[model samples]
Target: MSSTLLAPVLEREEYIEQAYFFRTLAERLREGVPAQMALLQIRDELLTTTRLPWAVEFLATELKHSGQLGSGMKRLIHYFTPFQAFVMTKAEEEGVRFSLDHALKVLEGEARYRSENPTPAGLFVYEFEVLARCQLGYQNGLDCMEQDSFFDEDWRQFIETVRRSMSEVEFADLIYLYSEQYIQDQQRAGREGPFPRPLFGLKEGRIAKASHGRDPLYLFAALQRQLGYPEVPRLRLPTEQRGVLQMLEHKVRELELRLRLLEGEVRGQVEVIQALGKPETAESSLEWLKRLDNEE
Candidate 1:
């Protein structure tokens, strides 16, 4: 929690533009756009004279030299939060299976939440899920999260607690222990010292209590179902995206062949007797292409 690393809570409009940047960049990257080009392309789409577009321009230049967007973002500590840069670095790590597209989507969702004045409970749950579901190490991940300006000293201490004990402790128990319900119970029991304000809401406490010892994902689902917390983005396989593109290409080729057949008929290249020999059926147009191949 170095003061040097913590950025101010950004303006709501800035977060709105940031969400757009992440979503547009992730979408273009899937279409084979280069990282530097993606940043460059998104500049005009952002609001004029804003710091985000300038950050994007610098990111584009830094990406050219270091071949890592994380390095550039890290340098702009005043604009991009440390946690933001950390995610980008993890996504770019060598020999890692984590996806950059998934990371970007996670960032976009976070920015959208921040634009709406996110609560600490909502932000914490959403970010913790990103680390857990993606298998990102809790130590460094919590270290980065603690540096975010949205959380104060109490949050930093709680995060440290979770960081040290997460391997052995149930996550729901931890949330319940730090919630407002816990503090209210303490007061009812006649504890006299001034108790610290709770970090989690009463509803969060209830969900955590119900989910104790169950799969922690069930807790996350409860939170999202009862509350409007943002859901964690699951990692989508690149091969699945490629398969979809291939399917679309196959359909396009089928249509092209059908068009060529119509053109042949107009040119009198098709024999009327041969055309009448094999009538059209409900089979795929690909089957029609196969029949045409056999005729030749």
Candidate 2:
């Protein structure tokens, strides 16, 4: 086989080992083992194993095969890959630090992709690919909770802040998207007693009646408007709203600043004109200026 082809397979082998380690820890955690202990075990495994660089190479290879590597993944590889690497290889100039929890989260996220779309014999491979990324991010001290983006620091903070600030209705919507029956029970209980303040307040009889027979999209739209959020597109994903809101807030601030600047410029021009002399008539003055400019 060509070294180009054999290279990925070699990387896959390293990923397989790391994936096994992560899965072992995950199983122990599920069985009520202390997180510290599990982490120690993971750390011990890392210490005794081949160098981390080799492990990372394996992961990059596996990610290539899984197609989970999107533009975000490419950017990540570009910053870290090496010469003759199937992906870009640049030296790791900047250092990153991350908690073990962050590493686990990244691993779990990748593992989830496998569960969401299963394939035979490839299960372990998928897990390994994800663990490799988690390891890379951990080494880099990057926050794995955030989605990959060009602006790492800003985007990470934005995602975490948005997740924390999610309204009860938005939280419920998220839960509903993932689990319908659980949300229904929560709604029913809210209506019956101690009516918890829901973000959407759909528990209110009047609101429900008004929203009756509406589709989820329409209901969500009304809720968004009521909550003073911008009108979102009907087909947009729920997870996408936080990023959208951040962009909107950025744009709104920019526009506000521009408006203030324009107002100041206009005021300065008006002061200059007033200093010159009171216009014979505001309309006539404007007309005269236009005529003068046209003549020039």
Candidate 3:
């Protein structure tokens, strides 16, 4: 656990700049730029007064050596949240499909949300979705999220419950049980135990209840639809890549076509070479080969 987890230390403006820094860094990274270079470039783009410039400058230096932005972020615990660092660290793990670009987008959206009036439920759902959708460790993700300063003791306790019961329980039911609607239902039934304060509103409870027995993703979608919470960005699912043999064959064919066109151009034979790309026949192939041999 981080020392700053008990209290938020950074200003709202800092988070705003962090969002910009991450968004710009991610964009530059997609352009095939190295992580250190991307951080250096984005560091210059940040406002002079914001701590982000200093932070990213440090990140650039750290990335220059370690090549891991998450490590840099973790070192700056006073500025960046643990969840932000967790996302990046998870993205950096080997054999994981999560990329630095996707991790940046996730942090960018969450920072923008935190800069505004973020609710406990909203942040929880957003962070949880980041873990669930990205296939990060659920227990570790929830542990990181639970330490956020925005959540109270009740929220922390509930997150622990989620950590314990996650493998055995439905996420929607978890929310529904802790919500206002559940408290109301208990009251209506004349149950008299001390109830914890509601972490979720009546609407959220109803939505979670309605989402019972369904895919848990729909619960997150419903919350995003109704509450305007930030949605986690997902890595693009990998499409079938071309096989090595297929690529080699395609390259060979391309080289042959280019060679034919070049030979035709040298001999001032434009029409015949231009038609070489069209459907090939044995006769046309022979004619093209003969023409190429003439140039030789």
Candidate 4:
């Protein structure tokens, strides 16, 4: 494993700026802005004192050259975490339905949480929930997470154990076993052998115990409710849903345009040939709509 996961080296301001960077990038992409142009524009908006602007500049340059932001992020190991790079790489992979925009939102949430002074348990649960909900591979995802500098040695070991035994174990049970509540219960039952060091506290233990045998998402939710852990952003709509939404939006736009054309013709201010000759982005009513028939 790369030693880049040792400990968070960036300042609080860096994380704050990173959160903004990711958020703005994701938003721009959603608004139909090109990635390289969005990166350049956002670079000017970041705090000049922070390193994020320089990093964004580098990402833009890399994207211009290699047509990939993940490649640049991977090369900037000193600035970006391995998990961040891993997420980007996964998002950029061919045949993966996960889009780069969705990955940016995920990073935005993580960076925002980090800027708020996150605890190891909270970060672990947040990152794990991201992987679980996003359908990112648990084995590789947990491996990258285990190396995060935010986690101590014990946390790393526990994550490694989870990565290996996740198939055989219920996630909630694992949390319950390594928690202080488990030790207390064992002592009360007159069982006195060596016990693993508690990584999760009493609150987590209780929540996990209550959540055992249920969906792991319930365990995550219970922890979030009781502990104020950072919430993982939900995944983007599935491909089929997105396609249906796009079709509906296209239909709505077409209807609006047709209504505008009818009104223009009734007023004797427009002709079919003139309207069709105008660019899709013409300042007329068509400006608000794409050529609905254009292929994506």
Q: What are the per-model numbers of colliding residue pairs?
A: 0, 7, 0, 0
lDDT of 1 by residue, 208-238 (tens): 8889889998999889999878898776667
Between the candidate structures 3 and 4, which one is better when assessed by lDDT? 4
What is the lDDT, from 0 to 100, of the residue 65 in candidate 3?
Answer: 85
The global C-alpha lDDT for each of the candidates, from Candidate 1 onward, is 0.83, 0.37, 0.80, 0.83
Per-model TM-score on C-alpha atoms? 0.78, 0.21, 0.79, 0.79
- In model 4, the clashing pairs are none
Model 1 scores a TM of 0.78
Q: Candidate 2: where are CA atoms >4 Å away? A: 1-18, 24-53, 56-146, 149-170, 175-296
Residue 273 displacement in candidate 2 (angstroms): 99
Q: lDDT for model 3, on a 0 to 1 scale?
A: 0.80
Q: Compute the lDDT of residue 252 as modeled in candidate 3.
A: 68
Q: What is the C-alpha lDDT profile of model 2 across 45-129, one tens digit per residue? A: 5634444334444444544565322222333333222111211111121253433333434444333333343332123222223
Where is the poorest 10-residue window by lDDT in model 4? 287-296
Per-residue alpha-carbon lDDT of model 3 for 179-220, expressed as tens digits? 999899898999986887788989999898999999888888
Candidate 3 structure, TM-score to reference: 0.79
lDDT of 2 at 80: 21
Candidate 2 lDDT score relative to the true structure: 0.37
Question: After aligning candidate 1 to the native by TM-score, how far in Å is the CA of 194 from where it should be?
Answer: 5.5
